[model samples]
Target: MTRVLVIEDDPIIGEMLTLYLTEEQFIVQRVESAREGKFALGTFNPDILLLDLMLPDASGTELCSQFRQLTAIPIIVISMKTAVADRIQAISAGADDFLVKPFSMQELKVRMKAVLRRVTTPKPVAVQHTQADSASMPESQLGLSLDLERRTIVLDGDHIETTFSEYEIMKLFFQHPGRVFSREELINAVRGIDSFINDRAIDVHVTNLRRKLEKNPKEPQFIKTVWGVGYKFIK
Candidate 1:
């Protein structure tokens, strides 16, 4: 069974999520505070997390960042804050997706499935080579080496961790160096054609990728912004 950890302060909301998700055959564990949520992370070890932005102890964004540092588990922020800035903040803080409050249970389930699908799907390793050979392959102009099987990037001979979205974006950029991809195209490539992910979310993922891959994110080397068009990877 797919395990889900829901960190929501409102008793009603927590109960509703537990009831609905349980009916869908998910192993649901709901906690009422950030403290409890942190405790459950070790004990419950959920496959995915549904987090509320407003918590009794700590803000959800803080917990999001903390949890991200601790685990690669996908997080979906469920909040009453509907501002675009709030959504962007959550995504930047390592949330995979954000849903506004008063949302339909059906929509929440769809978003959950989408987030889970993106993280769970495996990318095929294109080359048949030994690990050493793969590691020694020609590096990108930015000196980054990708390992498809591990879904990680080696930068300056050090392994760097990447979120599922960031890894997908990096893989696409490397595959089509110098090709400008519109936000919609990039979104479709990483999150699927049916994805409801907004353009800004893609920007956030790219920004996160730049932080890890670029020596200076203010003036990127390989991942260049094409202004009105979108972005491109220059080899």
Candidate 2:
């Protein structure tokens, strides 16, 4: 049976999650503190964990970081902490995703599905290499007429340039228009530093990439939010 570990301290919330998960047909284990949660993880061997950021024994982010060394099992941090710093911290600690507190069970389930999808789905076959070069590749895919091979992004018919990291970020999205890539996944494709690159760096690179490529960076249409996960291409 598929197991889901719920690490929530609030009795009412814990029971609610248990009821919801049970109805979803998952074998559920509920724990009230970080220590119990860690113990459950070992004996239960859960496929997914719904972790609360505030725990009696340890913060969920700290716990999850340690847990990642033990297993790559998907973890979704569900918390009241919604600050950008909170989001970045949780992800850096090896969480697959984050869900702010006061979310519906429906949203919870969707995030659970996304985390499962990301961790379980096989890596996309690396974009096929081509001697044809990035310039030779189709420009329509870029949302601009950029010479991809030469690493010069064309803006208003002028060659605007991107850093190597920025170019890799663009190419990854350009290769699959409309496909979203979690920042962790993006780093993996770019510098083989999926586990090491800071998430903020990805955000910065994307910010600059959009500025160079999109006509209206404020209301960007080419790259869009996947909400609670990552970014994707729209054009």
Candidate 3:
């Protein structure tokens, strides 16, 4: 069974999530505060985390950062804040997705499944060298190699962690280096064209990717902005 840890302060919302998730055959453990949530992380060892932004003890973003350092498990933040900034903040803090309050249970489930699918499914790594030949390639020759099975990026002999969206975006960039991709094209490729994700969200994902891959994010070397157009990978 898939284990889920929900950190929600509101009793009603917590109960509703537990009930619905349980009906879906998920093993859920809901907590009402950040402290409890932290404890559950060790005990429950959940496959995914459903976090509420307004926790009683600490903000969800803080916990999100902390949890991300401890585990690579996917996190989906649930909040009443609908501002684009809020969504960006959560994603920057390591959330895989964000859902506003008063959201339909069906929509939440779909988002959960989508996020989980990205994390669990192992896709082909898009790079010039195959995994077997990667070890034989010179360090300078190896640009960015994806390990979809582990959901990680091997860059310059370093293993870097990436969120689901970041991994998807990087995979697309590796497949078509030197091709400028507009924000709309990137959003469509990563999150589906029908997704309501803000265009700025793509910027946030790219920024995060740069932080992980580039030596200096201020002046990125691998992924460059085309100003007015979008971005392209030069690797």
Candidate 4:
């Protein structure tokens, strides 16, 4: 039984989410503002959080950053902020995913599972490559080489810090260069089965990866977007 803390100001939306999540067998605790959410955190010990950007007491962005400092719990922002910038900002502030308003409950469930996967799944231990593993080595593209065995990425011979999610996305791209993967496909591949694809979350991850791997993130040379479809890797 997973415990979820929902920090949403709207009583209607909060109740709606609580009812739906309850139907799914999740233990939920709903709060009307960031202050209440923070106060409840110590007692509820929730596994995940459904946060709203607008609150009576504090901004979700500030709460998100504060929450990250206190705990590593997964957080999914449920907000009306649909702009790409808003989504990116939320992610930057520490939310694992962002769902725009008018979203379906089904999508919310899928996204929650995806974020949980990131938290609950054990990370693979980095190791030295064997001859057999060499055959499966991640491909190098545009001076970027991902040493999956070493669990590190080398950009022009320099190692860069990267998150597991970013590594998963990049690995898929390296495995299938020039193959355009829709956001849904990417989420499924990276986050596993029953994962939901939030386009904005995908964009934020891609943007972060591009900054680390590409010479110019604004005009990437390795990862290219297939407008209206998704993204692909090109040498």
lDDT of each: 0.79, 0.69, 0.80, 0.75
TM-score of 3: 0.81
Top candidate (TM-score)? 3
Question: How well is each residue in 103-153 modelled by candidate 4, as lDDT tens digits?
Answer: 999999988887675554212233344555555555542267776654566
By descending TM-score, how would the candidates be arranged?
Answer: 3, 1, 4, 2
Q: For each candidate, what TM-score against the reference?
A: 0.78, 0.54, 0.81, 0.56
Q: List candidate 4 segments past 4 Å from native.
A: 121-235
Compared with the true structure, what per-residue lDDT tens digits does model 2 show for residues 1-235? 5688998998988999999989988899999987888788779878887889888888746787776545546667888886878777776666666777787898787767654543332111123324455556566553364464445555434555444446556767778887878878896875453223466767767787678667788788777878788999875
Models sorted by lDDT, best on top: 3, 1, 4, 2
Worst 10 residues of 2 by lDDT: 120-129
151 Cα displacement, candidate 2 (Å)? 33
lDDT of 3 by residue, 121-183 (tens): 422233343566768868774676777677778885456766667888888888999999999
Model 3, total clashes: 0
List candidate 1 stretches off by more than 4 Å: 121-143, 190-200, 216-221
Question: Which of the numbered candidates is closest to the native, going by highest lDDT?
Answer: 3
**Candidate 1 local lDDT, 71-120, one digit each (tens):** 66778889998788777777777777788889899988887887776565
Total clashing residue pairs per candidate?
0, 2, 0, 0
Cα lDDT over the full model 1: 0.79
lDDT of 3: 0.80
